[model samples]
Target: MKPLYNFILSAIGATLLSGCASSPDHATAGHDAAAIMPASGGPLLPLPGESLVPAHDPDDGLFMDALSSWLEQNNAPPNTQYEFTRIDLDNDGRREGLVLMQSPHQAWCMEYGCSLFLFRAHDDGFSYLSEISPVRGPLVVAESQTSGWRDLIIHVSGRQNNDARNVALKFNGRGYPSQPASAPGLAMNMLDVTGVKIFP
Candidate 1:
């Protein structure tokens, strides 16, 4: 399983071949600090249907089924197929699901980004937590926790020469919000697979 997981990470990283030519300088500011503004340029173009939101609940213990249903409800591209994984992100004695789906719009994929969905473990079922579109890096579960739930960190590379950065989303009882004010944790280089931390 470790080999398979690493392969997935490598595949996802490869998608960044057409990403920003250079990585941005990592910020040393506070967690709540605002990201560095984009470089000067012409007026921004309108981004139609850029945001994606979960429209329905996921089936219990079924990754593919839930993903298919979600795509239909959201009217995603007909030919879209996703890669997914289920892990106990929070070490809560249950597993949570993560899905990565690429968009059909090449123009919007300047960073080789994809739509990311996080699912919360329910009673034998999974519930939609939140969605983030155009996420550029591997979705990693942090070694830190907030309010008992582990933090989920994602990297966002620059689009059209914009700066690349990572953001952490902390669970808020319901789902991890789009932009969390502050999360004091570092991103792990690999996914958490140890089953020793399971909650009793």
Candidate 2:
């Protein structure tokens, strides 16, 4: 709860200072285009959506390790800010973790978007499970399942995509697609925004 409060304040400050402008041709909600939605009557595990950090960090600095590795690879500093969320991606009792590594220097993002990682919990702690590169939010944990895992509705844009889109990333046994722009499209009738947005 403390982490969530801090994250909200940070997000508000960032948005006010940066304006968080959108691309000129990016699709707006006015389009009413086809996009991801929860499967009919799928059970939802209620959780906070607008938090910038997890209520509790994964044990043993599992998340920080992954962030440090990514920052080192990109030559970004370890102090970069990020957004985090937890969801029951497998419809299991335990929730998995989602981290969006953000930096003022654009270290983690490409033209497409920033890198988003999903961590699976283990008895020892949390372990690296899968990654979705170049992603933006607010992301959705959909009720729809693939390979026994919930699908992710991610905001995608940039070079590969002429206009921005909400792409559905399904777990393919191994993991979700690293590149969301190349994923399959959903029809336009997913009007109801079923799941909560994961980050601010």
Candidate 3:
């Protein structure tokens, strides 16, 4: 309730007590992107056992199960083809999964764009994180972080692929914005980012 001197003192105390703080749940103890990046940092890299082979693997029980659920929930065709990209967003050993349905029947896509699904890796399999829809690619992974997660920059094509605008989706301790049009507008040159192709 104190928004002045007490806040300043609290901030100072926070800095001092940061070392003793615990990491975000289901995430990290303390993960710095620099700590995981290669000496000569290049693009985002997937940590060990985090790569998605064949992009869409039918044998991947976890992924298949999640996709099925998503499709059923949306009343989409169960056989909708999808492409996936795996990258370590939180600098954790496990890479987060980004998926886009792009094939035969694009029931999930609209005039604005297609939907993207986010998932986190677990020892058992991929767990659903969130669903960001009506966004187009190429998506960019930003150097900036929020709530210990990397920010996302994606193209949001206004009606009929016209009036296009790129938006920034910062993780709000739980997930990114489900509707990107309401998210903050982002200029291409405003931040350091790695452009990623998720639809190809």
Candidate 4:
């Protein structure tokens, strides 16, 4: 319980800092957008309307209505329980919506993991961008090999004898990679320390 509480606090802190202009500027200046490959290499889907981020107002009926409508439109289960925060994932001066939801599959029991969803903000509402199941760590937006946008980083560790691994989901101009690689972007630089403890 303490660990979970700590994680929540850490996530909230990171998210709040995301909105501030004083946050670390990791952008690689003078980098050309053309250098980075487009995301997924698939057709970029356009939003149907002005999909903006829903306000964090629980008591407002209209807010609930819009939230429900967005959830239904995105095929989320009606009974799903989730909490969300807004963060500028790409450092593009726009905040992306991040939602942590309880997974339906209880069999995949995890002490500090949950389902994560990333939503792109628009004028009308937020649109579902990507999802990562069993996210064991806070979602961090960082600079990647791509010049145009920041990448999404998640750390996951569940099985025994394995240290937590950081997975970077780089954004292609359109969206993030549908299937991320085991070691995304400069993971080769990371030394393999599986089953080896440095701080014994």
lDDT of 1 by residue, 1-200 (tens): 00111011101111111112122212211112232111111121111232221223222224333434444445554444344445555654455666555435452233446556666654435556666566554555665677887776765555446534456767787567643223333344234421221101
Q: After superposition, how far is residue 6 of candidate 1 from its true place, in Å?
A: 32
* Candidate 4 CA-lDDT value: 0.41
Global fold similarity of model 3 (TM-score): 0.60
For residues 42-80, what per-residue lDDT tens digits would candidate 3 score against the true structure? 122334354443333212234334434444445554345
Candidate 2 per-residue lDDT, tens place, 28-79, comes to 1111222211111112224345223234433223433433343334444434
lDDT of 3 at 116: 79
Off by over 4 Å in 1: 1-61, 106-112, 159-162, 179-200
lDDT string for model 4 (1-200, tens) is 01111011101111111122222222211113232111111111111232443243111122223334445444543345554444555544455555555534352225647556566654334455665556644445553446565666666565455655667767767666643335444362223312111101
Ten-residue region with minimum lDDT total, candidate 3:
1-10
Pairs of residues at least 3 apart in sequence or in different chains that clash in candidate 3: none
Candidate 4 ranges beyond 4 A from true positions:
1-67, 103-112, 143-147, 159-163, 178-181, 184-200
Clashing pairs in 1: none
Ranking 1 against 3 by TM-score, winner: 3
Reference-based TM-score, model 2 = 0.61
Leading candidate by lDDT: 3
CA lDDT of each candidate? 0.42, 0.51, 0.52, 0.41
Better candidate by lDDT, 1 or 2? 2
Error of 1 at 165 (Å): 3.2
Candidate closer to the true structure by TM-score (higher is better), 3 or 4: 3
